[model samples]
Target: MSTVLRSIRAAYCTQAVVDWLALEIETARPTQFQWLQRTLADHFGDGKRTYIDSIDADASGATTRFLVRLNDDHCRTVDTVRAALAALDQRHTLVGPALVKLLEVSLDFYPKDDQARAYLPLLVARLQTSLEAAGGTSHRLVGPTKRAEHLDSTDTPDPRRTLYINNKLDPLAWRVYYKITDRDQTLPRDQHRARVEFTLQGVGLHQYGINTVDDLAALDFGDFGHLLHFRQFKPLPDLIANMKPELAQLVQHATRRDRNMISLYPFGLHAYRRYNTGKHAGKPRNGGHPELRKHSTHTTADAELNQLVRNRLHDLTQFFTQNWNEK
Candidate 1:
C-alpha cells in the first residue's frame, strides 16, 4: 500500500458553532491584573482599538484595580489553532489556567447573540515574554441555561479573538496566546510607549510528575532543547506507550502536534506551488502514488502560528454545541 503523509490537521483542529458562553477570570494578584491588560492590548493591537480604561493601586504600590478596553471585531475566527506553551521558555514565569482564562475573557467577543449572556472566566510577548506572575487565577462559566450582565454589543455579534475548548479532552493541552504592553494609550500615537519590564516568572512546572520546586529543580529543562516541538514530539511516543489514562488527553494533543509538524506544511506551500509551478509535488516527488489527490474542500489556508491572533471578540449567544454545561 502506498503511504500518503498527510497533515493530520483536521484530527487536532475543532470546528463547531457554539453560541453561548459567560466567562469570568478572577485574580487576586496585583501584577497579574496589569499583565492581563498589557497582554490584551498587545495581542489585539493591529486592527482593534484597545484602551487602558482605568487603574487603581493601593498606597503600598499594589496594582489592585485594572480595566482595559479590547475593542470587538465581528469578522474573526480562531480556526485550527495550535496552543503554544505561553511560558516563552522562562522557568520562573507563571502559566497554566489563570493566564489562559484571562485571555479567553479579553479575546472572546460574541457579537451574534446580543440577547444572550454568560459570566465566565479566561500570552506571551512577541517571542519570549511572560505574563506577570500571578496567584489564584481562575474562571467561572455561567449561563448555558442562565444569564448575567446581558452584555450585548449588537444583534449580529462579531467574531472573537480566541477560542480554546473547555472539555475533558483538551484541558490545559490547548494554551495558545500572544504577547506585550501598550500602556499610555492617552498620549499621541508618536508619543505612545511604555517600559516593558522583563521579569523572571515565579511559576514552576507542574506537568508530568514534576510539580514542586525541588522536582522542577531536579529535572534540567536545560536539556529540553529550545525547539517547542522537541518536547511535544519526543515525549509523545512514551506517553502513548505507557497507556496511562491520566495522560490520555495529553497524548491526544501530542499526537496531533506530531502530525501537524509534517502535514500542515503542505497546506501552506503545496497549493501555492501547485498553481504557480504546475507541479503537484512542490519540489520533489516521493515513492508513493504518482499523482497527488485534490482535496474536496480547501478548509485551511491559514498558516499563522497557533499563537498569532487576528480578531479577538466576545458575544452573548451560546452558539456552541459542546461546553461544560452542554455536555
Candidate 2:
C-alpha cells in the first residue's frame, strides 16, 4: 500500500463497518455449521457414523443443517455464546489464508517498492466481471438513492460461491468458502445425500433399529419409497466402487492432523493472525514497513507456489493412476 492510498483507506475503513458488513453477508450464506461440516468434509477428513441433518435450501441455494455435536450437554451455556461472538468479531476482520498466501507470493514477482494496493480496486472490478460471467452478482448496495437511509435496508446478497470466485471476497473480513447451490436438483456443497440425511422420519425409524444402509431393508418402504427417491443410485454405485480407494487415501492423508489440507507445511497461520488483527494494512509488499517486522517473513517465490499447485494436480493424477493399476 502506498503512503497516499494507505492514508485514504485508513481514513475510511473502520473495524466496526467491516464487521457489520461481514455479519450481514456471512449470515446470508448457509450457516457456519454448514460451512464447517461441508468444508471439513471436502478439505479435511470424514469419519463414520457422521451424518448431516435435514437440509432446507435457502435463497442462495445454500442449505441449512442441524449441526450434530455429540456431546451437546457440555456445549451449552454462557461460555459458548461468548466464544461464538468473539470468533465472529475476529472472523469479520480476516482475509482467507489461501488469499494471503497468494499476495505474499506475488510480492516477490512484482517490483520491490510497488504499491500493489493501487491495482486492487481494478482487480476487484475485474473480479465482479468474472463473477457476473459465472452467473453471480457483485453485491451492490446501489439504488436510486441520494440518501444513506435508503441504502440501509438494501440487502447484502447471500454469498453463493467460494470467496476466491465471488466478487464479494471482503478483503476486510475472513474468507469463508461458500457452498453454492445454483438450483434445485443440485447437490449441496455440504455432503448431505438424500439417503443419509437425518430427518424427522429418519429419527423415528432409528428407534426401530433402522440406521445404517444394512438396516435399510428391514422396512419395505412400499408406499413411502418417495422418501428415498432422491438417492440417485444408478451411476453412484459404480462411481463409489471405482473411487473408494482414492477417497480412502485422501481421508487418511487429511486425518493425519496435519496442514496437508492446504498441502502446505510449516503454515503461517499463527503469523497470519496479525493481518486479521489489522496490525498491517496488507502483508508487507516486500516484507513491508518497519511496523510489519513482527509479522513473519512472508513470501513464496512464484515458482514454489506454482510447484505447490502442480503438486496437488499431480497428487490427483497419481491417485487415479495408482488405484487403476491396482485394479
Clashes of each: 42, 2
lDDT string for model 1 (1-327, tens) is: 001111212111212221111112223455534455445435444544434322455655455333332222311222101011122113113323222111112221121221111111111111111111112112112232343212121111111211111222321212212212124245333321111111111222233243322232233322211111100122334435656677766757764767433221112112111322344434344422233332213232223322211111112112211111332
> Could you give candidate 2's per-residue lDDT for residues 7-90 as a string of tens digits?
323322211000110011122234545454453234223242222342465665464333332111211222322333334335
Clashing pairs in 2: 94-173, 94-174
TM-score of each: 0.18, 0.17
Best by lDDT: 2
Clashes of 2: 2
* Candidate 2 TM-score to native: 0.17
Q: Give me the displacement of residue 217 in model 1, in angstroms.
A: 34
Model 1 Cα shift for residue 71 (angstroms): 5.1
Each model's C-alpha lDDT?
0.24, 0.26
